[model samples]
Target: MSKTINIGLVPFSCVKLAEADFKDRAAVYVVLCMKDNNEWTVLDAGQSCEVNASADAHPRNAMWKTHCPAGNIWIGTYPMPTAGYSKADRFAMERKLRRQYKPPCGKR
Candidate 1:
């Protein structure tokens, strides 16, 4: 079963896997790092029309790696189909998560 986490009250599916594991769909993506104590830390968050593509080309990929080991990184997604939610809605969700987490790599 997939794990779920709440980012500012919105539930998101999370996995300790790669971007390729996600479908090519519209969603808000959260990058997290599993700390040595087993807690998770938000590394970055964003919205994308095609999550897989966005993740693959994310500008903060190197920054994320620098903060956590590759094996400890997790990807969280809150899928929002275009038919149901607009781009603005997705962006709003992403903003909410960023505000709540204030991920270090998300500077600016």
Candidate 2:
């Protein structure tokens, strides 16, 4: 299925896609999700916003990560989120990204 991303506490300007729509696109959506959201991962994003986002929120590759800059996950009205970028926040994110993530098999 395409992946959808959860941008919690959203400002409302972002596109909202249904689960069906997320198929085959999950990777793209996840890569585009806001890097600042505490739930940078799909699971976390959903939990933070109480919304089930796309499963593809977690991609298994490095090229995709570079293509989809985390900052591009646009928010609508509310001021942009900054949690993931702060020193403390970034440290935490680095931990999460490293600990929780298991790259696709053989991805190295």
The candidate scoring highest on TM-score is: 1
| lDDT agreement with native, every candidate | 0.79, 0.30
Q: What is the lDDT of candidate 1?
A: 0.79
TM-score of each: 0.82, 0.23
Compose the digit string of candidate 2's lDDT tens values, residues 16-51.
Answer: 222222212111112233355434333112112211
Cα lDDT tens digits, model 1, 1-108, are 457887678788987646347779999888888777768889888888988744645778788888887557878898899999999999888777778889888753
Shift in Å, residue 5, candidate 2: 4.0
Query: For model 1, which pairs clash?
Result: none
TM-score of structure candidate 2: 0.23
